[model samples]
Target: MKKTCLNINATHGGFSLIEIMISAFILALGLLGLAGMQSTAVKSTIEIQQRSLANSLITDITERMQLNRLWLSGAGNSYSIDSLTDANLSIPNCIGSGGVFVNCSGEDIKNNDLYEWKQKFTGAEVNASTNGENGLVEADACIAVSPASGSDGELVQIVISWFSTVKSKDAAANAGATDLTNTCGTANAHRRQLSVETYISKSS
Candidate 1:
């Protein structure tokens, strides 16, 4: 009688080492994707918030100019500012005693409006928050008042420029695109701008 011996093994039961390795790799990739999405979402949120704030500030200054239309009229009248430092940062006193807002001359109001705008742009209104500044980054603004050709009124163009986290210089290079088109701020690829034009009727 010849007896043949058969060797059978049943030690390994569940998943193999290679299978576990592959699953770990896939899980890591999924987590990485989730982190990337979160980063992109944060950037987009900041972009929207900054743009909204810029528009609000523009509206504020334009309204102030409207109130001072009489002083803003005539071909000789102008307030074209190249940047924030292009003019003095001083503000005229318009508040009477007891924190009351007294009647300020058109010129005085204009000066005060610009001063306050700069402050807000620099995050002066920001309260104590450990997160970040409450205003635009590296803000630069220009308020150009172009008197109409025929003395109809003045054209107020508000251009606010700041550093945009949404688009970086490196990202712009990667996309082969220019981020800045207007001649405001540093006019660099990292700069973003918000502008609006409004016509203020001549009151005088």
Candidate 2:
């Protein structure tokens, strides 16, 4: 019997350079997408926090005003502060004979409340640091009152404005949305604002 010789060829079984490069490209793209999403989420979260804080501050002042019915009853008439500034509010430390918390009078309490509220904006309170929980930026407030026809009630409008680090996309469209021209004190690209309206009865 005669033996026949056969030749066989062997090939390497690993990924080619092109395949590795493609995989690397795909991974890079995925990472980039994730980074973009994270950035957008952070921005959105910041905006939501700011809005919530503003709402809380507004509610706080409103509740205080409601509690002081005498002050809001047009007797003291301290509820109608317009374009209130930090300089406009001043309150002495409320302390008793033995360093206790002294109860202020009706109008005095109103002044104290206004001072405290403005301090939240200016970050002057002990709990408030610069750009702290009180506010992310310089803030201002306004209070307006309108007399109602007959004996219904008085319309009160409260507005809070703040400078925003994030630029507004629709600022032009919302140019006339608020009357807070000097909110940030300068014509900046980023400006945020909130407003609340309520009616206070004359009887209150």
Residue ranges of candidate 2 with Cα displaced over 4 Å: 1-4, 93-103, 122-134, 170-189
Best by lDDT: 1
For candidate 2, lDDT tens digit of each residue in 1-204? 999998979877999999999999999999999999999899888888777877887888888777876656654375766566645777746744563557667777777778777766555664544434555466667787777678646777787776676787423334553453343234556767777788767564
Give the Cα lDDT of each candidate.
Answer: 0.73, 0.69
Q: Between which residue pairs do clashes occur in model 2?
A: none
Candidate closest to the true structure, highest TM-score:
1
lDDT of 1 at 190: 72
Candidate 1 TM-score, C-alpha based:
0.79
TM-score of each: 0.79, 0.77
Sliding window of 10 residues with minimal summed lDDT for model 1 = 170-179
